[model samples]
Target chain A: MRQSKLVGTLAVLPSFVIVAGFMAFPVMFAFYISFTKTNGLTYDWRGLDNYIAIFSDPIVHQVFLNNFKFLISVPLVIFSALVCSILLFEQFKGWKFFRVIFFLPNVLSVAVIGLIFRNAFGYDGAVNQFLGLFGNEPMQFFIDSNYSILIIILALVWSGFGYQSLLLLAGLTSINPAVFEAAAIDGAGWWRRLWSITLPNIRKVLGFVFIINILYTFASLFGFVFVITAGGPGYETTTIDFLVYLRAFSSNNLGSGAALAVLLFFFIGLLTLLQNRVFKLQKDD
Target chain B: MSDSISSRLTPRAKWPIFIGMCLVAATIIYPLFFVVVTSLRSNVDYKRDPFGLPVDWTVTNYIELWDEYGVGRAFLNSLFVSTSAVAVILILATLAGYALAKLPVFGSKFFTATFVSVMLLPGPVLIIPIYLVLARLGIVGDYSGLILVYVATGLPFAIFFLTLTFRAIPDELLEAARVDGAGFFRTLWSIVGPMGASGIATLAVLQFLGTWNELIFALILVPDAQMRLLTPTLATIGKRFVSDQPLTSAGLFISALVPLLLLTFASKYIMRGLQVGLSR
Candidate 1:
């Protein structure tokens, strides 16, 4: 029995070392470093200064607002995914092929997706070429602030709706077909059935997608911003991650960068707690 | 939207849904088609008519990209890092996840919570101290450093996934193997490995795609031009070749190739893996 316990310890030791070193430790260190100003590996304790600066900074304010603005993608993604999933759930014809192709973008590299989106909407790209057929000039999509954010959302929807739809499809699959059939027998139209049977049944899945999309909008916008706008025209579309990259590494301002990061950590932590709570409340899946 | 009732609907009702789906599929396919066509064309041909079918189709961009540009090296680096990390992830996650699931390991519950909670840590910010830690260890420029980071980050999902997968395996099989004089490693190798093959394969495919597509960590950890990965190379070379669409598209095609191949081949596992993650 003692030897078996020892063997179990040996088995788990490698994973424990890596996780503790990389993930667990850094989180605690992020809190520690956030409080102090640093220069050239020299640290000076400056309590709350870093936080106050970022809070008061207008650029940081705009970046947070940009994140909130990007939250608009959540509903757009859900609505698009919901409609597609419902349609696909119908399994009309070619649904299998469509399902496969739809999942492709979800697995694609962000760098590649960002490039494709950039090219598709670039001044000399396809959208412009189509617009040119009507004698209109090519439009600059990335350089402008409003258009840049819009394009990112469009790209997110393009890449994400498929995955979310499949999730909804999974949810829709679990829902006993009898419910839909019974609703139909009771004179429910498609919309009526969807609202009463479909939507209500899939709320848990919807909530999951909703929270993840929100988390994604916060955590994973870096590649798009880095590749497409480069946070351009003047930090207009810069996401928190991109800003952290800039503030922490590029400008060599680790102190305040770490400060903003700690704030982001708490924000994401709060959101995840909320997600856990939602799931706990639902307690279904 | 189930079978018995939908089967009663006339074929006429299917048209709108069919066309709408086709339109959605087109949104995905058309752009990719344009990318493939553009990559195969000469820059001048692409330049002369961005919308036209290629009059001068050639693999020159791909050939030149491999032979002259640093893409070949980046490709190799990406392959090595992704494969190495996936291998490590499989070994580590399997052993740990197996223990957590099947063994009377001490602190199993605590270990599980520690790993899972790490998943929710904000990545963009989390990279900072991770970078600092790697730098502190002076492994920032080492392939081992980047590989370790990938393995560490990927373990949570892989372990969590495998835990669920392993929990489904009946204990009687393992007990029988043990009763037949099989030790822990032997049972794990002959029994658990084969039994859990599909789930493990699903994890490998998912992790490989993830590591291949990763950008920021590779960018930050391995900054040397000689050691860069594919996605970050795209960012760097993307800036350098903004005007040369064919060459840039060729780079895009190269970086996107493996995951596309994985998607094409292991799409069953990919689909299963993705749908399964919703339970988390």
Candidate 2:
């Protein structure tokens, strides 16, 4: 029995090693480094100083605010996807074709999407050229902070709505048709059925989608921002992830970078806790 | 009764919804169309008619991207990184997934939960420490360093998927294999591996496409010109040569070609995987 257990352990040791070294260790190490100050070359333990420095900085405050502002897209994306999924659920003509078309962007590298959008929005590019016909000047899409944020969200929505809708569509498909039939037979309007039946039935997936949207907007926007804005126009468009990269790699300020990362990790952990609560509530019902 | 109601509602609802979906699809396809058309146009033609059909179509931009910008070398680099990462992830995750699913390993449940939670680690949040760790190990900017990060990031989803797949296989098969005196590894390779072929294929395709298109880690970790992957290379071009629409467009298409094909063909498997992975 011990030998068999040893074999089982051995089977998993490689993955365990990789995860521990790359993921687990770095997380804890990052937390420790966050409290220290370094010039990217060396470090000194100054407990809470890095955290204090970051929170006090107005630019860091703006990055956090921008991140939370990006969260507004959460409900917007979910609602749009929910509506689209409901439409697709009707098995409309070419529904599969539409689904495939929508999901195409999600599959392509975010880097590619970012590049395409960057070019499309570049000065004298297609978007500008189109605007020029209306007598508008060529705009610096990445230079303006508000404009950059809008562009970032546009890219996110363009690439992700199809995939999110597909997830919701899967959730919709899992509902028992008889339940819908019962609702229909009881004289519930379409809106009534959707509000009470469809929404409740997909509560768990909706929660998951919301959590994923937060995580995505928080961390996964790195590639897009890196290519599109590069956290440019003097950090006006910087989200936390891009800011962290800027501090760490570009500026060689590891301590402050790690501090911001720790905060981001805690933010994600809170979301995870909320998700678990939702899961429990879902299971309870 | 339900059929009749839906049928009655169809006329008013269906056409508007169809048109809306068509508009959405058009929006989704527009940028991609722009990329392809602009890639085909010469610089002079692009300047004249940025939004309209390319009047002077040319493959010169692609040739230049490949020959001058060394996109071919970057493509090979991306291919090597993605394939290597997939290979590493598949072997390790399959073994781990099988153990957690079938083997009577104590703490397997704990490990499974830990693995799932790894997805929530917010990847960019760890860039600082990971960079430090890799630099400490003297592997920063190396192919192996980037590949390791790719393998680690891709591991959790692959393991979760494979664990679910492995669980669906019957216990009797493993018992029968053990009866034949096949050892653990041997049984896995012979019985489990073949049985889990579809799961393995899904994992491979997903991981390959993911690592192929991954840019953040590649951008930061592999900064060397010779080591830069396709996505980062494309990004550099997009940033450095923003004025060269034809070249940038061609670079974008080339960067997207492989994964776009996979997304087009194996879309069903990918979506199913997303459903299972997300809804869990």
Candidate 3:
């Protein structure tokens, strides 16, 4: 037994070492740095001041709200993906072709997607040309903060739905054909069979997709906002990540950035736990 | 009555999917077609007809981008970084996953929990600290630093999928190899690795995709122009050519081509691989 234990420890040693050296230690170091008013390598301990400044700053409040805005948009995008998946789930001619095309945006880098949309929404852009048909003046999509956020949301949905649709398609495929056949034999219509059979069976996968999508969407806010707007028009779309980048790099306020990082960590952690609980209950049911 | 209702609904019910598929296809394909057309059009023509098909197809945009924008260097850099990161991730994740799945690893639960928890930590959360660490090591703004960060970031999901794949391999196969007098490494080499080839390939594609498309870490960690990857190069093009519609469109399409080709060729494996990662 002791020999087995030794062998087991030996087996896991490399992974443990790597994770400790890289992820865990850096996380703890960042947390420690949050309490200090140091600029990068300089060490000047200031307890609670960094945290206090975050709460007092109006910019931080705006960033916190922007982060929530990004988070809340996930469900809307996921819902569209769900509907798309349902439509694409059935067997049809050109199904595979359509699948590839829809998933194309997901494969492209977010930076590239942002660039494409940035041009599409610019003055003298394709979107303006389309709107010109209806006799409306060309509106500045990027200049207006509200429209900028909306444009980002649309891009997010476009890039995001493909992957989620693919996931849901997988989930849908896994459902037993006989169940649907049986529902039909019992005189159930398409909506009835779908409501009674498909939704419940795929609920677990849907929940998992929701959690992953939410986290991914939140993580990606920086790239899109950075590439397109740079949180412009007076920081209207400045998310937590962009704000941290601004504070740390732009303004050289490392201490405040670290504090914001810590808060962002806890916020994401709380959402993850909540998602886990929701998934767990669904699984148990 | 139920049979009659079912028969009546079958034809009409398919319309929703038909409409949905059409909408999804248009949304995805229109932008792709737009990019391609714009890339082939002259700058003047592009400005005149931003939404129209090119009257004369040409490769000038691509040629100019390659010659002027340092796209070739960025492409090579992206290739180098992605391939190196995927190679490292595969080796480490495979060994770790096999050990966890097959061997009696002590505190395996804790290790699994640790890796999964790392997934919960958002990518942006690590940017500042990782940058600081790389700066301390004096490797910031270099390829090696970016590669290291990419490997670390890709490790968790790679291991997660590999562990599942390893666990699915039959214990009887390992026992059979052992009965033939093969040692652990020999059994792993001769038996386990071949059996897990498909899984490994899937993971490799995923690791490659994730690293190739990663922009945030690449942007933050590598400040030098020569070291910038393809995504950042595209971002630079956007910054430089804010009004140059054709050039921007060409750059976007050029940057997307590699990943698009990678996906098209290995799409089956890519889809399977993504399913594994996302499911976990």
Q: Order the candidates by lDDT, highest first.
A: 1, 2, 3
Error of 1 at A128 (Å): 1.9
Q: lDDT winner among the candidates? A: 1
Report the C-alpha displacement of residue B265, candidate 2, in angstroms. Answer: 2.3
Instruction: Give lDDT: candidate 1, residue A262.
Output: 88
TM-scores for candidates 1 onward, in order: 0.97, 0.95, 0.93
RMSD of each: 1.6, 2.1, 3.0
Candidate number achieving the greatest DockQ relative to the actual structure: 1
Docking class of 1: medium
Between prediction 2 and prediction 3, the one with superior TM-score is 2
Give candidate 1 regions above 4 Å deviation.
B5-10
Global local distance difference test of model 2: 0.85
The DockQ ranking, best first, is: 1, 2, 3
The DockQ values of the predictions, listed in order, are: 0.68, 0.67, 0.53
- Candidate 2's displacement at residue A219, Å, is 1.9
Best by TM-score: 1
Residue pairs in clash, model 2: none
In model 2, the Cα lDDT at residue A148 comes to 85
Q: What share of the true interface contacts does each candidate keep?
A: 0.65, 0.71, 0.55
